[model samples]
Target: MLKGRPLQYFGTCIALLNMLGMGWPSPFLPVLERDPLTSITKDEGSWIATTYLIAGPVGSIIAGIALNKIGRKRSLLLSALPFLTSWIIIAITQRLGFLLLARFIAGIGGGAIYSVLPIYISELVDPPIRGFLISVMGTLTIVASLFINILGYYVNITYSSLICTLPSVVFLLFFPFIPETPNYYIVNGKIDVARKVLSQVRGRQIDAEEIQELVESNEKGLAKAGVLDLFKIASNRKGLFVCLGTMGAQQLAGIVPIIFYTQTIFEKAAADFPVIASTSLLYVLLIVFSAVSSAIVDRLGRRPLLITSISCCCVALLMEGVNLYLKSQGGLNSIGLSWMTLGDLSFLVIGYSIGLLVLPSVFLSELFPLNVKGLAVGFCNIYFSVVAAAVSKLFQITSDHYGLHVPFFVFSASSFLSLVFAVIVVPETKNKSLEQIQIDLRNKDEHNKGEQTHLLKKYCSEQ
Candidate 1:
């Protein structure tokens, strides 16, 4: 619709491929354990599903350092190197250790991509379509995950992995032609380049007033932020809290484990059913509902969407926990409710994809000022990997020791906590420019301080 919107859409291609490689192990875990050339134990198979997170923090740190030094386009190009190598390794690896090593390498690329891409896209697009564009990127990642699930079911793991490498190859070949962000050029004092790139993106020449506004915005953001600045500044501190809370809630609710172990969950819940088909259908719902969210996010706003999503997830998880509990106790079959596993999982997919899946990235891109955004979002992604790894392992341990219902119940409770957090803490960021968001964060903090002082003075006079 816009001048450079096609290229913006193409920019999301790497993200799609990133998730494709990241989610490769989800449906193939059981197959890998049974393959004679790369046989692994149940415990080792779990490692294959989660070891991508091991190197994620390191990659995020690298992305944080590179965002300013190398710029967004080059950082993305650097990330593609690891992605290409990892997928190639997976395609030919005969040893289980090699397979796990490949996954860790992919995690490195994934971490960098997650940290950099959101900030890049936010800076590139206009405010009117910013939410839609970002949400579309999230949707494409979901589509990639779904594609891997179906591909693993129909094709061999080696062949599927080799196919996954194509996205990286395409990105390397095409992405270099795209322009860097206007913000990055302005900050670096490349005014002519910034103007040319901005006009190209906007389909018009830059006017004097807009150019002055852009200069002033860049000037405000030019102050370099240290790690302490994240917590030392009140607005930055609040932004970090909001981001971590959303990411933590999503991870703790077992969304990562659910996506990574979809076939495993279905087999454990209902062995006789067609697990792959059910899993594929579940991901289809994710893609469909995530698209719906992309279409409506700017109109409905962030706060309401998050509230509705968490509420739906809480109910769905509770239902899933109850269904598993009944099935585990040997009563589910007698009552003719075996289909409830698929039902509950479909509910979870709808709930997660609509809001929880996409909003975390949106918050990361919108909340913090440019000065702290790269560092704050980098740390946020690092924290996301840690929680995801812990929760994924915890899901396996609890399900094996106690029952599948135990983890489901725990996740249900976690969703309730997340719901409370969303309602109480998350801010509305719809239809606001990046600079406007920074101003609002400061204004809200100052307003709260003024209210506290007035209440204190009132109490003193009354006493």
Candidate 2:
């Protein structure tokens, strides 16, 4: 177990590094477009982000198949190489064509990392610590994003692009320290090796009974679910709905617009504020809040935090819309009120950081069974990427015609709807085993129908 601790930590670190590589360049894309070598139009620049997400769904599907065959350790190592090459290309290349290709390739790496890492983490840790560890990946990614945004705000673009390479290097260094997941070994029919790997990750010498149970549980799960059988289950239906809903919520939470077009949002909000610097500082502060939220996720549980945080987001978005409405009406006469606008925007950022951004990935990871984990996550990501693309384009259009406030209003409504869906439909998965979760969802579905049947019989008898 002691030997395995290093490997678990190594996996966690690799997940963090993946997020850093994926997220760091996003906030500074405007600067990238503005560079003389590229000199892209605003619409074309937005496509860069769109293209990255376009690859995400496809990459995630590939990663699911690849991880099962190649194993977690090798898949992670291979994913890092593309990220390294992408950074180098962006740093050296003057051609727009090459730069787009590099970004697309980087997106593939990012998408795969996002899809596969959760499954890897799930396979590595015990049920108790799984949520906390998986949630940390997102927390760390936000932190890296915050750090890079600050750098881009203050440093030159060339330096910022170069600095993005460091995390990939860090990942490559740590790759050899982690072991393949026990589940992966079990699937490959290496029972003894699987047990050894399990003992290491659990940080205690697992008993032969426990190892036997794990093997049996995995085999039973596989027996119940053939490779192509995930599509047939009622539980899978709920899982798909939850995955798609959460992914849609995540993108429509107005996060991508904030991350990719921070300067633009700030420009609309605070005309006199230094757009780049202020937006960077805001991202840093919000990221700090996201880290704090991650630490509390397990303690508070998923549902309550999701509800509260998303509700807070709705309020913040409304506040921003109101601020914009007031400004449009020539109502910002006081300096005090002007400063309050920044405060309002910060509230929106913090609310989103705490709720929508951090929880969706954690929830989706817990929602799916192993049989379809990869493909389910990949489909969710496809929706995420598609919405991200749509939102980016929508932001540009709304800002051009209706004003910045229109986008905020749209997001505010979407978040409110998400909160409703979460409360009514999403189950609490905190600390539950995957098998247990599947059973609960099935039972819940059964219970609902039983209640309906009872109500119908009672009404008919009464009539």
Candidate 3:
């Protein structure tokens, strides 16, 4: 037992709860659609996913304001309430209308939790261990996702739906034990409380001078910031673009469609196989692989991991596209023992687990400065949610109109573009301080413009 470090344990527990609650509902989408209570058409089924993604961005934007005003502990407890209620409603109602509404509400809670946790962790933990701790959140979510998919495979629909409620219940019960973020306390001028929380979380008495320095630094940063000030900073703009591009690339990598509609895709393509069982097994395996990838992300550095991951994703997606194209051409229909299809699907999952599935959150946390971190993360999440909604709808529409290969081809092209963007625009931020990153980006931008200016000056002087 790490004495006096209740906050660390509490944070891990909260993260685990949030992940379990949010991720478990995901694998149930296919099963829900198949149930009599929610016999949705393919388009309508996609809307359920769309609703969650749309709600995530909206909820993320609201989270900062809510946390600033209401306080972190209170906000988290309040957020979990909706998920619990939503699960109960889902278990009983069985109406498509009610189901959508419930999912949207649950999504709001989940989104808020996701948007806020990184900021809270950054503020609370020491720098050396922060990456490891934050990565634990991703690991736990993947674990929960794997567990839930397995449960959904064997359990009855009603039971599976009911099982999603456990995390929220656990969250609400345990939330009271965690302390409010020390930064949030400082922001509100509760110095005594902030000091106490910091001491407890750090498992040692923080030097008063150090705490005062932090408070002073925070005050100066806050004083200089205005609503539009983030736009005026070149570093902020660069960071924002990187954040947005990274998030967009993560979604555009096509993992969302694969995770949410795995059973559907399997059924549509490999109807002869045990679709549900195979998909469930693959999801569980991918989650395990994703956790392993996340553990090594910090060591590999952001840029190499991102470039490598996106490259692998592009290749995998292209392979999937080629497979789909072949099937469309009736080349595989005659072959009764086509292990090639299975191999291709495994490649897709492996590519995703190794690359796109693991890096977005890690990149986001590393790239942004603390001053505008919360709002910047919130905005990035907004892009993610919007792209997810659009992609989910696009996958359904494209699959119906142009055949399944079209969507995979589109996703592969986007991944290729993302690889180019990563190489040219994204910086390697391994083991670097946030302030150092800001300086590097600003210098890079100045150097690029300086070269252009010199060329213009030479021409003008000659003319």
Mind giving the per-residue lDDT tens digits that candidate 2 earns over 359-401?
Answer: 7788777776666676677777777777887887887789779
What lDDT, from 0 to 1, does candidate 1 have? Answer: 0.82
Per-candidate clash tally? 0, 0, 0
lDDT of 1 at 213: 86
Alpha-carbon RMSD of each model: 2.0, 2.7, 3.0
| Residue pair clashes in candidate 2 | none
Model 2: how far is 233 from its true place, Å?
Answer: 0.6
Question: Which candidate do you rate higher for lDDT, 2 or 3?
Answer: 2
Candidate 2: what lDDT?
Answer: 0.74
Residue-wise lDDT of candidate 1 within 218-337, one digit each (tens)? Answer: 565778779999999999999999999999887776777876776666766654667667767887898999999999999999889988988888898899888888887886772244
Q: Is candidate 1 or candidate 3 better by lDDT?
A: 1
Highest TM-score, which number? Answer: 1
lDDT of each: 0.82, 0.74, 0.72
